[model samples]
Each structure stands twice: as structure tokens, then as C-alpha cells.
Target: MPTEINFDGIVGPSHNFAGLSPGNLAATQNAGTTSWPRHAALEGIAKMRANLALGLTQGILLPHDRPNRRWLASLSTDYASAPPLLRAQAMSASAMWAANAATVSPGTDTADGRCHFTPANLLTMPHRSHEAHETARQLAIAFADPAHFAHHAPIPAPFGDEGAANHMRLARSHGEPGIELFVYGKSGGAFPARQSRVASAAVARAHGLDPARTLFLAQSPDAIAAGAFHNDVVAVANEQVLFVHEHALADRDAAYAEIRQAAPWVEIVEVPADAVSLADAVSSYLFNAQLVTPPDGVMTLIVPVEAAGHPRVAAWLETMLAGNGPIRRVETVDVRQSMANGGGPACLRLRVVADPKTIDPRFLVDAAKLDSIAAVVSEHWPETIVPDQIVGTSPDLALVQTVSSARAALLRVLALEGVLD
Candidate 1:
């Protein structure tokens, strides 16, 4: 039986919200939310400090507990609409979100939960299977399949770019079955066109799959190597979809043709300028923790809700209601306050596998308490990485987790006004 996606957690850093997405910055300066874990600039130096202090393998930014609902609705609607995967979403309390997610079904998973969908990793995410599996293991402990106790959720600790096989190995060693690994032949990041190919090769070598069985590199029309950001590809209810770059130097045509051979039932297309390609967008959503729901559903989209004008939001609202998707059931609200607190709709929420006996779809209800969110969009990113030319990458987790402090303060003020909840 094939494993399919039911839902997925969107991931990505929201620049419109967090002023402090750690990127390539210098170390001589003081570190704050926006300047935490950047790339190679003052990187290793800063990481040394974090490693000693908090086991900082990588500087991941997080939202302050409460999420933006407006953004989530937008995201959910985007997912469930026509063209499918590139437009899916989930629900949040009072905001909305949107992403290039294709589906929620996993093509394969180890007994532990290490999963594999397709080349979305090759195109977008440099390393995502390892990340999500880690999330399941370290944070949620959800992938503890008994048979593969040691290999459950093959999450890489010192995560190196080993490619899909390494990721699959980690997942499978922990208990997943054999996954098809896409092989690429390069290694660099500046030219995203080669990202898919390079990532595919790197992942295969990492997993050390049999070179014979592995479909070695056969350059796509234009060097399409990487998959979408964060390895976010899904197949839902037999429907499949994923985002691809419309014009990234990579061969969009080859990608469509080849990925289909294995992911035979997927919906692949070019990324939209108005939005990141559905594949890349998945990582973007994950970076921010956005969801996929519908229009009428209240959501808290956390990113630059204000960056795109109300009309854009309005346009977004309209675009969300396309087919038999979920957008029709949502309502949108722009909650900038939550963005100010470092998380938009997606950041604060996570998608976990359900434990039938105790599942609660309202995963975020308790986390959204008035005083639960309290950080503000970091007001200090441009100062950190501009020196290096690595334009857009957020700093660290401390910048955007939960905003307990601010929420508490709000409660106090509300209490003083005799309107506390």
C-alpha cells in the first residue's frame, strides 16, 4: 500500500514579519533576533557560542507561541484550490496563510516515519526530510516505531548534504522502506538552476545507495537539480501537486517529465512571481509555520500581511476560493500584532500525526491564549548580513518562538481595564 499525504506543515521564514531572520551577517556586532544564525559570514564563530550554550546545530528562527490566523486561511485556500498542490492551506484562529504545498500524503515512510515524496528537495529544500523527521523526533517524539527504534525518523544530527538517500537511509534505518533517490552532479548554491541536480547527487552519496540501482545524473534540459524548498511534496486522496520555478534556469520541462516517471500522479508547474513556486513555497511556509485551509476559515497569516496591500490581501482572498477546495469555509483577518510578535499564522502551528485516541485537530487552541504570544518582528536584520551579499535568510529560533511576555503584559493591561480573559 502506498502512503499518501493527508496534510502538511508549511515552513519558511517570514521576512515581512520578523525583522530578525538570521542570515549572512558579521560577528563583531551584537547578536539579536535578526542576527542570530546567518551563513558563513561570522557564522562558525557565532555558532560556537550557541553550540556551547544551547546545542545550536543550526540557527532556526521560531514564532512567539501565538500564530497569525489571517495568513493560514490564505494558505489553506491556496492548497485546496485548482491546480491543487501549489495551492493548499490549513486552518488557524483568525488570520490566513498561503504556500506552494502540493499535498499531505507521504509516498513512503519507514516504520519510524522517515518519509520520501520526490524531488521537491532537489528543487527547493537543501535539506528538509532531516528537518521534519527531527521535528517529529526531538520536539514531538512522534516517530518512535518500535521495530526501528534506533532508525525512527532518520534525522541527521550533524546534518550534512548527503542528498536524498542519506535522508532516506536515516528514515529507513529508523524503519522506512527503500525510497527512490534523485541523483544530481553538482555542488553549489549561487545558481539555483543547478540546485535540484546538485542536491539529488549530494543526497544519494549521503545515503550511499547502490550506484547501479540509482538513476544517476542525466542533466535536465537546463541543469534542473534541486526540488522545491523544504522537500514539501504531497499526494492527497490520489491527487498530487508540487511547485516548480517557471523561469529558474533549471529545465522546468525536464523536471515535469522526469519527476512524473516516479511520482507518476503529480501536478507540477512553474513557480509564480506573485508567489514562490509551489515547491519553493512549501519551504517558505515551513520556514514560517503556515497552514493550508480555506477562505471563510479565520486565520492568522504572520508574514508581511501589511507588505501586500489590503487589496492584495483582498485579491488573495478572491484567488483562494477557486474549486471544491477549503477556501469557502474561511474568513480572513489581518493580525499584525501577531506578526509583531515574531510569528504569523504558520510559525506557531505545527502538523503532527494523529494519535487516534487523543487527537485534537485544534492543535493550537491552547497556544493561542491572549498572553501566549508576545515577541515583535525583530527590528534588527538589515544591519546583520548586508555586508555579505547573501540577501535573504532569517537568523534564529529565539527571534520568533512564542511571545509569553508580551501576552502576559497584554493580559495585565486588559485586567486593569476590567476586560481580562
Candidate 2:
């Protein structure tokens, strides 16, 4: 039996709207709005509980410390001396999107018969670049059994790495070896291309994946320019099914050919361009849906509430679900707080296929842990955070103290007080 665990990042106290991501449409459109850290954290916890209720193995990834002292020290500046954007980036809670947490190769695919993880360098954006180190540390601790898990550092940069956001796997069964698809973007008009061919190849080699079982596909430049910054924005796969947009890749036919050759049993479901334009797809985040095979063994789509509001997307979804197919149902989740910051259901997690007994107990989720986390968020997290509090001539000292206090409270709840330190 294959145990697939979903590890979701706990929303940090510094969750705010700073419009730091260039190619992310939501972050740009909702630039300076007041963010509710309390609501965001609670909403995320609720999502985890919902997944657990479905009989899925759920885990938690602790948030990275904000006002990162290492980052500031590297720049040779304090908060006051640092640039406004730099300060905001250092305090970013963007790590909440755990999809970019790391690139995972299950034991079934590796030569050593041990799972491999390479933390994403995330060098595309200043806010995300600092996440790799902390992500590696957290993964190492959570997956401490070297006999079962092998943790590797992020790939060297110049070749940007965005982790599993640009990677997907397909197999006949979770226990069997799967074909790993790595999507790289050739050009990004405003935002830099986050994943490179070199980086993808490096990770595959590091994981000891067979070359014949790996496929490298280039992302459509048009999609990247239109704010489909990461490949996850336009494509997702689960088990033997791949759900994607028509314009997701530069060479669709070639990519499909490669996929079919490697995994002939795979099913490809392509959404027509006429039905949902690239713009609509990016805005609605239709492809960012979570494709999960629950206890019933039927695949379900867990999408954001925003998808139901998009006319074309909703119609297409209804039509698709009306028929008998791999995707048996459509479920909507309210992650508005995360959606406003350019993350959705899929972005909130990193999927790992491993035995439950092999994982660290601290990262596992249960009803008691969920209740305790909810309580901590409601009581300690800030109700709202305005842009002025973190950005501008003089930052608010009180806001800083509040954010720090909230993180401490969370650490205490998880019994991980000194983990990050």
C-alpha cells in the first residue's frame, strides 16, 4: 500500500499584501489591502482538517521565521537601513505556499529505494529566494530517518529552481515507479523564469531517477507572460491522470508523445483554449486545483471558491463532472486569504508518497492537534495588517512585536519552540 502524505505550511504571522511577486496576478491586483493573519491561518488549518476527514494522511510544515536575521545580515543592514521592498521581502510569509517547498522523488522511482528531496532554491523572487535553507532544515528534521529518506540541498543557482511547482509525477499506482515531468519556461516577460532545464536535470540526476523515466518539457512563453508564472498554474497530475490547459506547454504534441512513450497508461485531459482562455485560466486558477484520490478510490478536484465564480470555468467544470470519469466530484474550498496572495489549494501543500510510520510524529496531523492550532491562531494572530505597518518611512514597532509574539505562540503550540533557532 502507498501512503501519500500532504504537508501543508502553517500560515505565518507576517502574512500581508506587499505585491512582491511579479508574475503572480493576485499579488499584483491586491497590492496594499489589509490582511487578516488570524483568518488566514484558521482557514488553512480548516483545509487540513477537511483533508484529514477524507481519510488522507495530513502533515504540517512550520512557517519560516520572519524578519529573517540571516537575510538582513547577509545584506549588511538592519531593518531601518534596508530598502522598503527588502524589508517586506525578508518578512514575507510566502513560505506558506508549500507546493514550492521541495522536489520529491518517491522511493519507488529512485535507484536506492529511498525517497529523495531537494529543497527549491526559489531564486526567481527576492521574497522567495531565502526559503531554500529553512525548507531544507525543516525537511531534514521531519524526515530524519536516513534509512528511508534522503535530503539534499537546493540546486546551485543561476539555474533557478521552484521545486514541485514545476514538477509532476504519474503512475498506474502510488506504489509503482512513475514518470516525472519537469516543466521549464524559456522566457518570462516581466518576471524571471523560475525553473531552468539545467536545474531540472540536476535534480533528476541527484534523485537518481532513470533518464528514460523523466521528461523535460518547456512551458509556453505566452502562459508565463500572462501570469501563469509556475507550471502548476496551468497543469496538474495525479495517479495516471493529467489535467491541463491547451497552451500549457510550448510543444504540446511532443510533450504528449514523450509522456505516452514513458507512461502509456496515462490519461490526458486537455481543456480547450476556446472554452477557457489563458487569461481566464490564470485569473481563476483552474489548473491549481488539488487532484486527490480519496478513500473511495475516485479522484476528486478540490478547487478554490474563485473557480466557481468564473462563468466559463464553472460551466466547463459542471460539464466535466456530469460525465463518469476519473474525476468523480468537484469540491470548493475557501482559501481567499491565500488566493489573494497568489496561492490556492495546490500551492498550499507538498505531496510525498511514503509509509506513515517512517515520518516524524511531530509533523503528523490529528483532530487534537487541529483544535489546538486553531485555538492558537484565533487568540494570538493579528486581526489585520496594513501595508504601512511594514512598509514606508518608519515601520511600526508594535506590529513587529505582535508578529513576533504570534510566531512564539504558534511554536509553543507545535512544541517546536527552538526548531527554527
Candidate 3:
């Protein structure tokens, strides 16, 4: 039977704060600060372990080789000689947020009856544009079986695409056919709007989704201007439940009406703006929580620790839990490292609905596999990355070797080298 399997990105050894993303408030605020790569990676593994404990299937995507040598070569520069700004962009760990990896259409929702993956071009952000190639390579490997999956190249440029970060689906169960929603930004005020509506339509068409079931919605420009770079930053949906902020969509009433019309059984759980302003929602990532239906049939919200600490979010959550609601339980995980870089728990994963047995086993994990990955991370990842290491004029050979070797060690431990190459 098909089930929701979350494939999270393993934090890379080159994980650092270069402040590359323009609209991501956390990334900009923490720019030039110290970074802990080893800690970051272990935290990601811990999150996977937590989800595994919840009896949810978990999968992982290996980090892309950093200091993106190929990209540098294209620009007629190498990391050692590239300008400081360019070097930082090349070394960015933005790809660690796998939500932008691809737009996924589960077998049940597609005409071909096979899971379809369209890697996002990510053309809007300079640091992230080069990711599609590598992401496609990884997806091709993980879902390589022809009988079960179909892979498509990214939607070509002139149209920016940010993949699943701007996508949501609602249904009664993971195995059932569902309503897919594509949220695109028209204007972001100070920030460039990523995920063009045209791109969203292209993906829906490519996936062969029924027009009646696919809804193209506009993201609130106000929300985007307030640093909600992607719709996922202000909203997330799981089987039949859409946990969203009041201002997440341009027209909440119309969007909700349309949603209800398409999937009449959908339970729209809107967090009031007066209780949690868009700014607080963005900061605490209250709406970005992963809303999932666990085995017991009670829905749970997997949130970041920051949300649990925020006063307004905590109070609102307490009230919500005290009363009877679809979200019956709350679970928090520490991903401060990724959080600092503007990724909450929901940002760190790409949800794919498929039978686990059809996917490449190496890509899936259990406690033992996580143990092996954690051991490699603890033993090989850099302890710390000072700002100078990334933005300094001269290249630090020691840092370079450490980052390269750390990933190499992980690939060797997993016996999955050349997968990224």
C-alpha cells in the first residue's frame, strides 16, 4: 500500500551562514555568525530518528558536493580564486532543505499511475540554481525503478520553480487520490517572487493531474513580503488537514471555499492572525509544522522547538490542544542549525507517497542505518565553521579537505559513492 514517506536532506559538511537567501529572515539575521556543521548533521539524523520512533517511514538524500566546483568552472573561476561573494554562494548549504528538491505527484494522483518527480529549476536564487542537476541525479537513483516511478527534467527557465515548498495536497488518506494545491507568489515587495504560477501549471500538466482536482492558488504578497519566502513557511498540509496561517493565501475565504468545494471533507485548520501575527508565525514557524496522521488515527503536529518556546505560539497551541481538534498531539525536534539557516522541520523534508519496498533500500532508513550515518558524521564532520572560513579572501585548505573528506567518509560508510557524481 502507498504511504507518505518523508525524504529528508542530510545536512552537508559545508553547512554555513553566508546569507545567500534574500527573503529568508533567519538566514539573513544569522549571517557571518559561527556555524556547527557536525552538530547540524547530527541534529538532522536525530529528527529522522524521532520520526522513525513515531512509526513513520523515513528516507534521506545525501548532501550535494559543496564549494560547487562545477559551477565555479562554468564561471571561469575555482573556489581558491573566486571572489568572496561568489565563493560563499558556491559553498551554500541551502540544498539541505529538500522541500525544494522536486514537485512530487503520487501514483494515485497521476494519469500514468506512477509517482512523478519534476526537479525544481530554482532559478530565482543564485546560490540554489545549480541544485536541479544534482537533485535530479539523486532522485533518479532513489526512485530509479521504471515500473513504479517517472522522472522529468525541471521546468525550464524564464519561469522560476521552487518545487514542493509551494505545493500542498489534501486527501482522506495517503493511498487515495487527492486534491493538489499549487501556491505561487505574484509580488514579494522587497523579495523576488519564486515559484511562478506558469511553472506550477506546467508541473500539474506534466504530472497529468485532473484539472478538477488541481487548484492553482496565489500566495499572499503580504506574507511573502514578511519573509515567508515559500508557502510552506506559512502553511503545510497532510491527508485531509491543512494547518495554515490566516494570511497564508491571498484570499483565505475564496481559497478555503475552493478547497472545500474540491475536497469537501478537508478540515481547514486556520490559525488566527490576531493570535499569531504573520511575523510571529514566520519567526516561530508555527504554521510550518508537519501535520501528519499517525497510525492511531489521531493527527499530530511535528514542530520545531522554537515554536514550543514562543509565548504566543505556545499559548495558542495549548488552547488548541485543550479543546478537541484534529491536531491532537504536538512533537518538537531540535534543528536549530537548520532553523538558523531558515529551515524548520517541514522545510527539511520532501513528502512522497509510495510503497517503501519500491524505493531504493539504501535511500530508506531504520535505527541501525541512522546509527551508521551518525557515527560517520560525528567522526568526520567539521566541529565549527567561522565566518572567515567562508568569506575570507584566501581559501583555507584545511577547511576544504575537512568538508570533502567528511562527505566522502559518509558515502563510504553507506557504500553509496558515485551516486552524486
Candidate 4:
């Protein structure tokens, strides 16, 4: 009964474009632009609906409390007294990218026979560093069934960990024991390399994964310099397929060799840089696509509309599909809002391989549940959010009230008001 369930983060009402991430090109390019929270949330729900329609299990994680009062207080300043930069950091809805929430090792790969989760201590970014507390709390709630799950607190810092964004898993199937790939970054030109090698090792140990079945590889400096902030941005793995850009790893040959040794069934589908330049790959977020296997046993690539529109990416995908490639079909969804903030479809989801029944039911959803969540989003989420409105010399009390009420309305409808407590 074990399966891969994608737990997506509901786009929060305070979603905005402050360009807080230094290495994320899209977020920087779109900074100061207006954001549509309602539209973003609806697009996300629509994505979940698409996956649900594909016969895959789907679940969701609620948005974290924004203008994180606790984080602000830790910095010795309240929202009203915080500077513009501080205010911007506190109000970030970056948590909407659930992939950064935790690093998961399914029961099949753990020593104790229970799925293991380690909440990431995103210490590299000021805007994201405060997320672990809320992320950990929510992970505890969703995976509270101790019989099948074990949740660990964030990895202690000085060790920056970005969770599943820098991790990948390959198995014969979701229910089988498989190899775990952990990609760490050494240097990234002007951008901070977020995942520390030490942090990844700690997570592997915490999850009790077999050393022989685990691989710790360095992310390509070229890819990171070109704005592939996380490994998922340049490569994504599902089951036996490793769909990646040629320059995604520091040494593709060594990485591939190790991967093949660990998981011989892995299909390395590398897109040559000549065919699709790294710039094109990152901008189009081509590799950020979610490569999922549906019920029909055919593997499908769920990509952002950006990838579908990019000339090189589209052409490459067309050729790949035409051939007898492992990825047989392509499905594009509009996540322009999340993309603008440097997250594509893969970034919006956290993949947990487990039985649907083992997860908290409140987090699971069907078409009807999605419709209800969409209704709440449409009725309450902000139509638009301008950066200046949330991060000026003094907080815009009206905008704050609007975002607060919007989330409250959603919780009430989902009957998850307990999340706030």
C-alpha cells in the first residue's frame, strides 16, 4: 500500500516578491513586482487536482504564520519597529515551497523500518532561516502516527540544510528500498551554497540509511553559478530514471557511476548542454519539472508552462518524447507565480513514499476537497500584494490584517484552525 504522496504547500496569502533569495534568479528578476496570492494558490490547487486525476495520491501542508512574530522578536524587534529589510524577511511566504520543509527517507530505506523526516534548518538565508520551527511543527502533526513515521527536529546549525530540494531517491518502485542521493554545494560564485556536506551526512545518519546505498555528490559550480540554487532545479529523480542536465553535477561521470552501482536500474537521461544551455535549463526550469509515474505505468513529466514555451527546452522534450525515452508524456501547468519566486512544480511539493492511510487525513485531498480549498482561496486570498505595502518604514496595518484574516478563513473552512495553536 506504500506510495509516493506529494504534499504540496498551499500558497500563503502573504505571498510576495521581495527577491529575498540571493541565488534564485527568477526571484531576483521579479522583485518589486506585484503578486497575486489568490491566483497563485488556485494554480497550486489546480496542480494538485491534475496529479489527483493522474491516479497519484495528493496531500497538502498549510501556510506558515507570516510576519513571523516569533522570528521578529528573536531579532529584538517587533514588526512595527523592524526595518524594511527585516519586515520583508518576516513576511516572506517562501515556506510555500514544501520541498524545503524536510528530507525524507521512506520506511524501506530506514534501519528502524519507519519513514524518517528531518526538518531542514535553512540557515543560509535570512528570510528562510526562521522557517524550521513552523515546518517542524507541521511535519510532526502530519506524520504523528509514530508506528509508521519518525520526525526529527531541524539539523543544528552552522550546517545549512535545504531539505529535499537537494535530495533525490531512486527505487524499483515507491514501496521498495532504494538509493538516496544527497547533493551538497561547495561554492556558488555570488550565491550562497545552501546545503552543507556535513548537514547531508548528518541527515543520512539520522535516517539510518545504509552507507553503501547512499551517495553524497557535489552540485556543479557551473549550474549553481548559472542560478540552479538547489539540486532539484537542475535534476530530478523518480523510481529508476535520473532526468538531469549534463552539467548538474560537479562530475557527472563519477556521480552516474556511483548511482549506477547503487541503483543499477537507474536510467540516466542526461540533456546535453549543447542541446539545452544551462541558462535555458535554469530559466525555463526544465529540470525542475516533476517526473512522475502514473497509474498506467507510463512515466510523465509534469513541467511548468515556462518549460513548454522555451524553444530549446520544448524542442528537446519533443525529441525525447518522440524517441523511446523513459519519459513518455509531458504535462504543463501554470505556476508562474511560484516560478516568479524561483520555485517550479517540483519545488511546490514534498514527496513522501508511504501509505495514504498512514498520513493525517486532514492533509489528504480528493477532487471535492480540492474544490473546497480552492473556494476558500478564491474567496479570501489577496487579489494582489505589492512589496512596498508589506515592507515600508512602518507595516501597512491594513494589508497585515487582510493576510491574517485570509489565512484564518482558510483554516476555518479546512477545519484546521488547530494549526494556528
Backbone clashes under 3 angstroms, per model = 142, 0, 0, 0
What residue pairs clash in candidate 4, if any at all?
Answer: none
- Ranked by lDDT from best down, the candidates are 4, 3, 2, 1
How many angstroms is residue 389 displaced in model 3 relative to the true structure, after the best TM-score fit? 1.0
lDDT of the candidates, in the order given: 0.27, 0.91, 0.92, 0.93
lDDT of 3 by residue, 1-421 (tens): 8989999999999999888999999999999999999999999999999999898999999888888999999999999989998889888888889999999999999999999999999999989999999999989989999999999989998999999999999989999999999999999899878989999999999999999999999999999999999999999998988999999999999999999999999988889999999999999988777777777787889999999999999999999999887889999999999999999998899999999989999899999999999999999999899988878877676888888888888888777876654
Candidate 4 residue lDDT tens string, 51-152: 998998999998888879888998899888889999999999999999999999999999999999999899999999999988898888889999999988
Where is model 2 more than 4 Å wrong at Cα?
none
Report the lDDT tens digits of candidate 1 across residue range 1-421.
2221112121122222222212111111222233221121122122223222321111121211122323334445321231211111111111111111111112133222332222222123321221232132222222233322222222133322222221111121111233343433232243232224444544444434445334433322222222221221211111233322343323446645655565454444333446533333322221232223212222222223332344443354345445333223222223333333233333222222223223222222121221221111122112222211111232232322322333334335323212211
- TM per candidate comes to 0.37, 0.98, 0.99, 0.99
- Among these predictions, the greatest lDDT belongs to 4
lDDT of 4 at 323: 97
- Determine which window of 10 residues in candidate 3 has minimal summed lDDT: 412-421
Measure candidate 2: CA RMSD. 1.0
Give the lDDT of residue 283 in candidate 2.
89
Clashes of 3: 0
